[model samples]
Structure formats: structure tokens, C-alpha cells
Target: MKVEIHNVFKNMRYKFFQTEDGIYYIVEIKPSFWKTLFPFLYWFFPFPVYKVEDEKTIEGIQTPESWSFDKSSAVLATGGVAVFIATIFRGKIEMFKTELPLYIKIIFLIVMIFCVFLIRLFVNKVKFHDLYKHVNLKQLERFEIKVKPQSFKHIGQMFASYIFFLFFSVMSYIMFFLDGNVFVLIGGAAMLIMFSLVVNITVKEGLTKIEFIK
Candidate 1:
């Protein structure tokens, strides 16, 4: 059977199918408009999905083969862009109370990406950290959904992110008035609003209970 699932905003769609052998496989993932436009920031992230074996896999899902190319492309494109920006604005941008060179900034960005990749790999091991990932055949068959609240540490991290976005938005607004960079204005507003919506969803999902009935 096929079904459509969406998040709180109902902007993106998760298309999935359940086979006779009781395995759930995603057929297609329709990203939101924002994600489609800014694929560099959103599309590269790894989302959790069931480990597909040879017998029960579907076509359109992010199989290992397809994801290899996608991941490489995203990393290369992002790194290239970061290096280009750093090189162009080397003396203009300041860091650690001084202006850093192009090579140093590029190295820092690469290190940050590597650290994030490692952290995501670790998070994928835990089952209940993300509710959406638990929509597998085994969980559905048992009709038991595990809902875990965000840890205080995680909540603190999110709050920090919220503040960071708020700052970025304000700074971008000021800079736009000064120089009128349209890209900066659009990006800042988008980041601020998206992070706000995420925090809103996190706050509202407190102790949500789900039960599947026959």
C-alpha cells in the first residue's frame, strides 16, 4: 500500500510503500520549495531510512549507489563555494579578533563539515532520536510508537541555533540597508524563519502520543 506523510508544515511529502513481506520502503521524497531552491544547504544532509536489502528495495529511494554520487556532489559543491567566497573576501572578513587568510578559513570550513558528518553518523545509530525514522514495518506492525523528548542538551543546542539565526537575520538586514545585497537579505530571512518554524515544532511536539488502530 502507498501513503503520503508530511511534517507539521505539510510542505514536503514522504511517499512510501509496504510490501507483502511487511517491509516499508520509501518510493520518493518530494522536498519543499525552499529545499529545491537551496539544495546545497538542505539536500546534502543524511536522513534516516530503513536499510534496504536486495530483495525488498524500491527504485527512487536513496540507495547506497545513488547516495554516493549525491553526497560527493554536495560536498564538492559546498566546499568549492566556501573556498571561492573565502578567497574573494579574505581580508574583508575577520575571525578570532583578526582577519584570517583564505587557506585558513577554507581549512576551518572543511574541518567543521567533517565533524558534522561524524556527529550525524553517531546520531543515526540511535532509534528514537527522530520519530520519522521509526516509521518502519517493525514499529508499525507492533503498533507501538516510541516518542522521546529532546534531551536538555539538545534543546540547549537548538536554542543556541535560534539565537544565532536571530543574530544573522538582524545583521543581514542591517547590511542589506548599507549595501543592498539581495542574496544576503533573502538568505538571512530564510534561515531565521526556517529555524523559527523548527523551534516551534519542537515546542509543540511535547509528549505526543500515537496509536495505530486496525
Candidate 2:
């Protein structure tokens, strides 16, 4: 009887464990109890998980920061459009049964304006030349930029500036006009709840979508 020992290599698709010196029995080294619960503990605990993509993979990925100027410029443009939309929506406050308090309305306006200001700041930081400077631009003519699940919370926070401006503005409209209509409030809230459900579902699954500029 002959026993052989093989050293593992990096290119191996799956790793195997060996047991006993005389018999090289291939074994699946199962995780300990603590290891099995690691995912749950890691999720609930504050300890951060850093997924390190290899240099090759990282170099291939094109995040929003690496996106073309034309595509990147649109964020600020959308922010601008949001400002106009907010102004237009506020124009009809008289239609509401009772308007939001003057101070409260002022706060909302300030927040929306602040969101636009922050977006402008973000845009200014983007180097438009990056559109052409990236060596992989030929391959990245169109590439998807993914937000990892772990980072979705931060991405949501980034989105909240705009969402607050938009969602709250809609709520303001509801408060103004729908105050008298019970059905409308209930229906509007139901719609909001459905929208929230969709957002959470997408976040939990993490977003991965191809990129296209038009």
C-alpha cells in the first residue's frame, strides 16, 4: 500500500483536507459551531466585513467615480430638476386644508436646497477628464457599477438627501390636501408602504445592473 501527499495550489477550485498518515482520506473540514454562526454574528455585530476584490478585478470595475462625464453630469442635472419640481409643488399650498407651519415649510425648503447644494459639491469633485483617462475605457465603453450589499446602507444614506426632498414633499402635499380625505391618506400611505417594500427587497438582494448611456 502506498500513501501520497499532494500540496495544495492557488489554482485549485476546491480545497480538500486529509486525515491519518497512512490513509489520505479526502475530507471536507466542516466549520466549527462558532464558524457556522459567523454569518449571523457578523451581520448582527458591529464588526465590519471588507470584501477585498483582487487587483485585477478591481481594475476592471468602473464605479460612478469612473463613469464618463456625460453620465456623471446627470446627477447634478437631476438635482436641479428636483429643485424646480419642489418649487412648482409648493406653489399650490393654498389648495391644502391646512398648510404646513411656516417654519416647517421653511425647513423643508432649506433641506431640499441643501440637497441640491451637496449634489453640486459632489459633481464639482468629479474630474470630467476621468472619462478619457482610464486605460480600460475601450472595454468600459459601457460597464455596470455595482453597489455591494454591505455598502447599500451607505448608498441609501447618499440617496436619502434626494429621497427626503422628494418623499417629504409628496407627504407635504398629502398633509395639505388629503387631510380631509381619509381614503386618500390611507391609499397614499399604502402606496408608500409598497414602494418601501420594493426598495428594501432590492437592497437585500443587492443591485447589479448593466450600464448604458443615452
Candidate 3:
């Protein structure tokens, strides 16, 4: 079955179908155009094929509670927006008068791009648990269906990230010590943390594949 993905920018479709063994799979049919255009905006964000273990039947998805500025998500969104705006206007600011090297400029640009996505990441309020709404409870036959886990698809992409970020983090630490550039140090720290996460996930994913094969 096809379900309309909730997109603020454009209408897109997500495919969800059931198999003979009572397994359900949800796959992306048409990705959001904006996401395609700006891949960096959603980098490292997981869009996993969920496994539903519970036998409970669900009706349509219920709307989540309204967002409040007092919440931590709201604070993160506001902070990301502010940092993105500052990055855009950094050239005009008096404190940043000294022109940065090309590599540093590129690093800052990448960080700024991440900031843009940070806002979206925090502001997005979707509850994946509620995604069972795709299954119609009214259809009595659907009640017996239990969704099983699917094999991973983006393991290669994650491994590539691990390589790139490992090199980047090493160079960042070296450059920071040599030139005493605090910005580079900060960027390096962030990339190092990201690299560690990628390594951990990649290992887990590899083990999962081995288990699946067994």
C-alpha cells in the first residue's frame, strides 16, 4: 500500500506493503525534492525501516501535542537558527574581519550547513511509533500482520562517512595544534564525535548482517 508522506514542502509518497510471512516493509518511493537537492541538510539522519513487534492494531495517526518554546527541542531549534544566521552574516561582522584560509572557510561552510539541518532535526516532531496508522485497523485481516525487520541499505554510505571523517578529524587536530585555530579544533571535535558514532553503528550493522546470514 502507498501512504502520503507528511511533508511540509511538497507531496511525496512512501510505500508500505506486506509479505507472505506476515512481514511489512516501508520504503521510500519518491524522496523529497528539497532533500535531494540539499543532501547535506539531512546527513547522517536515520530513516530506518521499523520493526513493529506489538500485535496491537492502530487507527489513523493522532496529532502530536503543540510545540512550546519552553521545551528543549524548541531551544535547540532556536539555537541552530541563530547559529546559521550568524554564519551567513559572519563576513559583515567586525570581529571576523580577518579572512580565513580556504580550507577553514570550507569547514565553516560545512558546519553552517549542519546548523541548518540541526534546526530541521529538532523542529521535526514526528512520532514513528504512531506510524502504525498506515495499517488500517478497520480492516480485520490486517490485524494479524506483524512487521518484521528488513536488511540495511545504507551501510556503504556509513562506512564512507567513517573514512572521510576519520581523515578530517585527524587533520583538524594537527592543524589546530600547529596554527592554534580554535574554530578548527571545534570542528575537529564535532567530526571526531560523529566519526566515533559511525564506527560504532557500522560495527553493529555488520554484526547484524552476520546474524541475519546465520
Top of the candidates by lDDT: 3
Q: Give the alpha carbon lDDT tens digit for every residue of 1-214 in model 2.
A: 1122221121111111222332121111122234222222212222111122233433332233444347567878989986896788574634533444656645644554455445433432342223223232233322212223335564565356335534754674356353543333433443433222222222122222211112
- Model 2 residue 119 lDDT score: 47
- lDDT (10s digit) by residue, model 1, range 1-214: 2222213222123323344565543322223435333332322333233423433224423233423236788889989997998798677543213344556544644554355445433533332233244344344322212222245654565557657766776776556445544455555555555443332222222232221223
Candidate 2 — worst ten consecutive residues by lDDT sum?
A: 7-16
- 1-214, model 3: which lDDT tens digit per residue? 2122222111122223333456543323223335433333233333333333333321122122452235788779979997997788676544433456768756865664466456434423232323434543233222212112223455466547767887897788677545656566666766765553342222221112111110
Clashing residue pair totals per candidate (backbone < 3 A): 0, 0, 0
Error of 2 at 198 (Å): 5.5
Colliding residue pairs in candidate 1: none
Error of 2 at 175 (Å): 1.9
For residue 154, give model 2's deviation from the true position in Å.
4.9
Model 3: pairs clashing at backbone N, Cα or C within 3 Å: none
Pitting candidate 2 against candidate 3, the one with the higher TM-score is 3
TM-score for each of the candidates = 0.33, 0.25, 0.32
Please give the CA lDDT of all the candidate structures: 0.41, 0.34, 0.42
lDDT score, candidate 1: 0.41
